[model samples]
Target: MSVARKVVIEITSDNVCPWCYIGKKRLDKAIARAPSNLSFDVRFRPFQLDPTASPYGVPKLEAYERKFGADRVEKMIPHMKAVGEAEGIKFDYGGLIANTLDSHRLLAFAASQNKQLPVSAALFAAYFENQQNIGDRETLIEIAAKAGLDADAARAYIESDAGEREVREEVAGARQRGISGVPFFRIDGLYEISGAQDPAVFEEVFAKIAESA
Candidate 1:
């Protein structure tokens, strides 16, 4: 079949953020349900909601409560649970929240292997569902292994801060682009879609882009 056109969807998100997880799932659905002729080159960009988060990790609930207050935490949990469930994500919220620099670096390594998306998904699941610490080297290496990445190489990469500068610069760039929150989608260097929008919204935008192409 002849192609409508190709589109590059760049997603800026963090592993520890629940909304980013939901956004990723919804975007996956959108891409899967989009027009067949419009091939997609999905790029998972790096962003950290809290750049100062401890690499050693803090209890998820404690961090949320400290940052957002107990009342909001109470409300946020149910909202996340409901939204997460809709996206087929069973958010445990019992995991540790850690600095995602290493997680982002690991994703950069995965990009070279053409496994960025799966690795990103795995990182989210590791933090949000599996009660694992994404900031830890062994946990990241295990997640990397699960994503078919070379374990020794991945361990060496994450252990040494190989992509730290590049990832930090990329995160800075996202901020410089006026993005303060995550799950930001930049499509084809032309359109911008913010937040965890519905799959239908993505499909509509995709169709419009394809039509114009």
Candidate 2:
């Protein structure tokens, strides 16, 4: 019997993106249904939804009102809530809106320790569920610790310039590739799947790729 082919999937996403969170959940479900004759290596890449957002952050409603206007944001709330519920995410967008660069940096640090996914999930929950300020160093350190990373090391890593350059370059590279959105998936560095597609969509794509391999 032929050995299962190894597939690498790199996900470019931002913690601030609601669709990214949903996409991650859907991807997890799809992977669970993948054929037995396949192996997977999944990595999370960085993307900044708002690079210039203040480090101190702003009230969620205020930020939303300023950027997308009150009426549009208001209309989006129910839809966002509905989608999040379907994905088993109880999104509470009552937190502050801050720069996610630091969060991205923490994720890079987590990647080094092979704790990226947990850290990423924590950040998402902290921001969307617990409504915490993820841009704060202390908050990030705490989240990192909860994800099995050393608190002191995570703090030092976020405080220093360790992962800043790499994160910036990755975001820039995404832009260069004409990727203007989050939750973008690249399979085997060849096939591209954009947005928060359905699990069946991901499963079908995985099947086709595995067959071709």
Candidate 3:
């Protein structure tokens, strides 16, 4: 038997993005289907879908309509909902506009504690499923605690300007790389996959990486 190949996958996404959540689920399924000889070190990177969003946020539906127009928003909803349902996610696109900066900062803090993935999932669920305002400090602290981080530490981190600069710089770097969209995946620092691609696409990429290894 050959040695298992280790691959690093860095996913640049925003918590408020429904497609990112779906992409995450598909990526998980693809990883689960990988051969035993393949190992993954997956990391979540920050990308702001709306950098100009207010910290207080606006109504989700209103924001969507304002940004994408009512007609397009109406057409996009059923599609997003269908895709989310297929991925076993119930996306409740209720009226809760979220400023994802604080959430991204929390993710950065979670990365320090090696809890990035769980915290990110919690944030996504809170925003999309539970309709919780992830922009709120209290909600974020609660989500962080639920993800196994120290609540007090998380609160303190949020109160302070701890992860702000890092998150901003990471977002800037992503933009500098010409990445204007969320759910962008960089595999083994070589291959790039954008949007909520199919599991077969992810599987094919993984297989190619494994074979090359």
Candidate 4:
């Protein structure tokens, strides 16, 4: 008799972080390629790259230019675009960058529905590939509906402050854990990996864990 080995992975990420998107893509690939005997339970925790950004949103390029300088943003874009293209992501600088608090709230609700991953992916795609403003309530409800949640319920939930406290607390917990950046992975709550690492890194870790089990 073979018993499947189960592993839990908690990813702390801000929806607007480019590196978090990249890290998620790589992690999904790694999980797909892992041994059949290993099953993964992936959950997401909240983080905020810019908590003070407006809900109305601002152009990603403009925000970057303002914060990092136009010259630096110009230098950063090409490299980010090249890296993103390698991962099959169409990076767009014209997308909106806004406070991700509402988006985080939506994700918390998705977790209860077991639709978090798809919802998260949809949000990232909307902002990074489709140039949609994820901070908008309507936009988020649309994303939730597309991710297999009921649109009306999503709208109702987003209109209220249902998960705000929990989301904020989780974000604070992540920071208290000394995670100063997005794309941080807490594997099995014991082993940790940070940044948008290569898929092979995850595969190796999974293999080691399985062997130990």
Measured by TM-score, the strongest candidate is 4
Off by over 4 Å in 3: 1-3
Candidate 4 lDDT by residue in tens digits, 165-196: 99989888888879999899989878899999
Can you tell me which runs of candidate 1 are displaced by over 4 Å? none
lDDT of each: 0.90, 0.91, 0.91, 0.92
Provide the lDDT at 34 for model 2: 94
How well is each residue in 49-142 modelled by candidate 1, as lDDT tens digits? 9999998999999999999999999999998899898999998978688898999999999999889878888888888889999999899999
| Positional deviation of residue 52's Cα in model 2 after best superposition, in angstroms | 0.7
Clashes of each: 0, 0, 0, 0
What TM-scores do the predictions have?
A: 0.97, 0.96, 0.96, 0.97
Model 3 residue pairs with clashes: none
In model 4, which runs have C-alpha deviations exceeding 4 angstroms? Answer: none
Model 2, global lDDT: 0.91
Candidate 2 root-mean-square deviation in Å = 1.2
* Candidate no. 1 TM-score: 0.97
The window of 10 residues in a row where model 1 has the poorest summed lDDT is 1-10
Better of 3 and 4 by TM-score: 4
- Model 1 CA RMSD to the hidden true structure, in angstroms: 1.1
On the 0 to 100 scale, the lDDT of residue 161 in model 1 is 58
